[model samples]
Target: MDSEESRCFSGYDGNRFKLVILASQRAHELSSGAATMVDRQGDKNTVVALREIASNQLDLSTVFGLAVQRCRKYLEEFAGSRGIAGHSSHVSPSRSSRHTGLGKSFVDNKSTYSASFLDQDKFLSGGKDDGIKGF
Candidate 1:
């Protein structure tokens, strides 16, 4: 306990929780492509974080703010790139048809989504569904 207590920094004022959060956030950021502010002689994230915290290279405000910014950026990118189209979920047949060689023979033969399902109004809920009429 003596060594652990002695190695502690005055910046945290003995707040172990704050130290842990700061270190963990820094470590996460480091793992997510952020460069280390401290020199790391093959030290892993925990060691780097601890060294940064001990030397006051990291701060609580920066950690919390970075987390929020990264989260927002992730969500924006997520909404931006939802599918292969990378545009909208409701893809029209004409727009989707542009994707050439999408296993047309395989899809037509092996799946229920055959050529019969291509009608714009047939699949929609507006008209009466004549079951297997197109088949």
Candidate 2:
């Protein structure tokens, strides 16, 4: 599990330091009642946040703010080389919780990720509850 988790730290161009900072910020958001951008999968907020970044399931702008513009050059190059128009969005577990009352399991057969969960503007302006911070 350590190896798997370590691989997640490389998601941000192998800059583990930056990845850690971003994950912590994302975890703070989760702990503050903001919906997750990815399935929780029984992991704590920190772990889930790490996995989200590792999988490119997160929009970098959400955590890094204006700093993301500087990083986008690399990402755009990587995406272009791989023929990816953009990162694919992942399903958040919140929708499933509505049907099963079990936030960790995927209960809805036709579940879709909420756009609100991926709102890039929320980090700086505060999230749905106005309690989440940008950094």
TM-score of each: 0.42, 0.42
Model 1 lDDT per residue over 1-135, tens place: 235434666434443544565577788988888888778878888777788767766665667456545544654564345432323344457855896544343233323222342332343222445232432
Q: Score residue 121 of candidate 2 by CA lDDT.
A: 56
lDDT tens readout by residue for model 2, 1-135:
257777655444433445555777778778889798777878899888887777777777657653344345544564456444333224344644464543221212212222232334553344343222342
Candidate 1 lDDT for residue 125: 24
Q: What is the lDDT of candidate 1?
A: 0.55
Which stretches of candidate 2 lie above 4 Å from their native place? Answer: 1-3, 10-12, 66-135
TM-score of 2: 0.42
How many clashes show up in model 1?
0
- Candidate 1 positional error at 16, Å: 1.0
